[model samples]
Target: MKLWKSRSGVAAWLVASLVFVSACSGSGGGGKASGGAESPPASSAGSASQEKQSQEAAPADPLGKYDPPIEITTVRIVNDTYKYAEGDTIDNNVWTRSIQEKLGITVKNNWVVSGDAPGGQGEQKMNVSIASGDLPDFIPVNSRQLKQLVEADLLMDLTDVYEQYASPFTKEIMNQDGPNALASATFDGKLMAIPNTGSSMDGTFMIWVRSDWLQKLNLPEPKTMDDVFAISEAFTTRDPDGNGKPDTIGISLNKDLYGGYAGLEGFMNGFHAYPRQWIKDESGQLVFGSIQPEMKQALAKLQEMYKKGEIDREFGVKDQGKAAEFAAAGRVGMHFGQMWNPLWPLVDNKKNDGSAQWQSYPLVSVDDKTAQPRVNLAVGTYYAVLKKANNPEALLKIINLFVETGWGESTTPDNYAEHFTKDGVERHKYIPFQAWPARKNLDIHLHLLEAANTGDKSKLNPEEQDNERQISEYLSGKEGAELGWAYERVFGKDGSFKVVDKYVSDNLILPNEFYGAPTPTMVEKDATLQKMELEVFSKIIMGDPIDNFDKFVSDWKKLGGDAITAEVNEWHASK
Candidate 1:
């Protein structure tokens, strides 16, 4: 099923963003408080220490200071699997509830609409507000739409608010939680939005192959890019499934709609040229990946595969879901995904006998040349906010509570997970840590495993709280195998923990630290230009002639690609 469609219908999409600052000057600081003024109530604690903390920390106020209940008006943006329920207005979602009960803020839904609805009412509502000169106190917008919002000047400046209102905890999160978390949110040295900060963990075009198929085919697991071709060829031609039909495909990938890492073109990562990643060359000049000479070779290989009937013929039009469906039903031999791919449409199918039976593997070294793999990692979706939010420092305050509650050095996993589970609003949809930021640390997993197995989660130090909670939940039979793996690593004294521990100990987790910021070029350019890029890239991967790929490069440059490059570099220089 399609989770959430992109929102659309800005009456004048370009104009809104083009003249945003000029348009939204006086739109802020308006309206009388709606709904009865009432502070969020105290929460239920499943344990004593948690109850003590709740009692001592002031009920339902994570922002540190409990202000008189202020009704915060906000526009809701529905994401995948996160939607508006019937008779369940936006004011009653897990996010709003967390804001009220934890921060003493009352949330009011000023506008509500669905992405799946026709005419893009949800997206249009925000556009209409901008056009009509009525901006809500807060709007949770994705990065894609954030550019438009920035251009339209519909959002609060957040510069003064961030500096003055942000708590030390929130500041630390933006500054210390790896690199680029806040950088992505900041534009021209101003805090535009509170970007989400977890997608950074994702990298590489992870390919999920059938482990059982490998064993059945009597073939060794693939270790290099050449092996990918061999394995795919075997699956397609050698009857790896034993069903005797040549129905199996070597690989299934979607070109259109998906974009970036998981898209069909992402397979090009094995060829060492990430199709969507705009990287600096040896001379520090910005360049598009698809136009690189390396890409020609990659496309040539893909074309050869397509001609061999090893690839799915329907690739050109297939979307992520459709391509993934083929793999899930055992019709495709291999599929590319992020590390968490199996947890989604594929894993969801495990209930059905026809569910995609798959296994995860790291990116194979292709060409026997480049050892480094190229993967795109996104930073944050949209920072959520409560409406009529009086606590400008609310984000910081909640981060503080979560940080302290996570691994404040003396906390234990069992205690933290039990409390977090009891207080958990939205369950992590994919990874165990998706719901909250603090749950991402691997160390926290170690502590939680200790707590869960010993029945004393509180024994874990605060420093290990997040990972510990994850482990505790998993060991306690929570959803997600990754969590279970963490638990086993800790309690079973498994080698995985030792390996991860060493990585952490030596600080071996080296992620790209790009200086990211939205540029006026992006705002100035027409959306069609980028849309064209996605379309052409998709076509090239779906068996479009290798020469057509050359045309795409020229077209991209002519269509604002060069301008965007200059703009990005200019922004980088200014920073």
Candidate 2:
């Protein structure tokens, strides 16, 4: 059964592609094959001698150049912001040249599309290729597409190739997030795709507050919900920006209400409520977290804050970019967001007002129970090989090259800068496929912090050593003053990842229970349910009667909630 249908936009394109593929496959015999003349059959004794000679001539070398060049064809996604050097095209750049030289592999693009396009055309092109049965030798696809390909029996089982060809570092990265990362791409106990594991901590939310404003108001760092409320009121009414007008907002939030940035998910987590996650109840049944009693309590608190003018009065109308204007203008003092906040609007705030000081802290708890920020496993992209391809192991070799040269101990500072950083060129883009350990960056920070404290760099890996040097230079007030901003936020004494480390050590992380494909009911009803949820929550925060929440819960159950609950439980039971 199809788990989901394309409702609109990219989904529509995917659905169309699937239908086209099915139709074309049903009407076979549309294309012809051609090849050069074949050599005459050899005697059994002669064949055995030739095989022995071949084995002796070509010893195994993962990074060694192929004796005869091999060409791999695939599509490309070009970032709009990317600028090419003088005459370099997307297909003929430093990365492609490097691959040709180091691995004797030539990459040819069948088609190229801009990744920044509005309609996900890159994915659409891929869908067309899949439908036409003209797939590239290797391709990167989402979980849903990967499922379709696997169900069609068009993809090669990479279990053996991965086992035999994957470098130790590549294997280490794949297992960084536990087997779940690989499990996402596993079918019938066989590995079909190379999962692109992402950092789990990327979704953890922390309170980014203006330390300058806190000091200006003589308030201590917030430790509880009460302190948070008090600080918000003061920042809003007490003129924390030092301007005569009461223009500062206590906190900034966008219309989405629940995202990694400028959303209320983290704030609600402080009340022990988790929305957008599947949680187990007292009955041991999987249920959606949005309609729980804890959510009502959290909404009530937000309502009170809204009435007191601590929250933006027009937040329901503001998108993330629009809401971020308050922060960029130094008119907002706090927000609950991910670790990357300091690298963005906060950095803009610093450039606009040099005195603006923002620091990241763990989320404050509403009560004595420690508040744990919610995170989700972020393995969504996967690389698959065509079943008819001659050398599926080449993909694994390319992955080894990426890891070794990018993050492994073999990386050199000079080569890294030359290929990856020179002329602001992103050579990693030329690599048709890549994957990394989810916790790679956090591990780097931990190593850098260790080296910083011990005054010994011997234990640092090559990547960490390079970062340490740059951060050290920035800390010492070296000539490249502007270069220090990113390092200071990500790896310095009070860097953002330090908070992530604290979360890890304290066992203060809540992960989603449901990590598999969407359920049948969910695929059909989730969008409608989510719309109702956002409307009801926004209304509650805008001072609608608290009773509306109970009605919402009842209505939710009546509208496919019960069926979805059963489906989710069935999945959980199977696991």
Evaluated against the true structure, the overall lDDT of model 1 is 0.50
- Encode model 2's per-residue lDDT on 1-575: one tens digit a residue: 00111122342233322211111000011111111111122112211233233334343344555647778877776655456688888888887887777777788988888863423877777778889988887887877678788889887877766765577667877876567778878877778888866657655888888999899889989889888888888999999988799788888878878754578888998998999888888988877888899999999988988898889999999776677778889989998887666555566687788678888888988999898887776775689877766566677777777666666555556665555555545555567777655566576677667777898888765446656776778667775443355557765678788898898878787678777666788779988999999999999999999889999999888898888888888878876
Model 1: how far residue 424 lies from native, Å: 11
TM-score of 1: 0.68
Screening candidate 2 with a backbone cut-off below 3 angstroms (N, C-alpha, C), the clashing residue pairs are: none
RMSD (Å) of each candidate, 1 decimal: 11.2, 9.8
Worst 10 residues of 1 by lDDT: 21-30
| Per-residue lDDT over 1-575 for candidate 1, one digit per residue giving the tens place of the 0 to 100 score | 00112111231222122211110001011112222323333222222223233344433333443546555555555433332434434456444555566556565666656562333566667657656756555555556556666665544445554554344444554553354666666667667777544323233345667667888888777778888889889888988767778888887656463432135444666677656556677977666665788777877877787778887888766666566667656777676654334334444344343322456554566766533444343453555332233344444444444444433432345534433332332221211111123123333445445565687855545324444455457557665555333233332334223433443455533333234534556556636666776766556656676688778778877877788778767655665
Considering summed lDDT, which 10 consecutive residues are worst modelled in model 2? 22-31
- Cα lDDT, all candidates: 0.50, 0.71
Q: How far in Å is the alpha carbon of 67 misplaced in model 2? A: 2.4
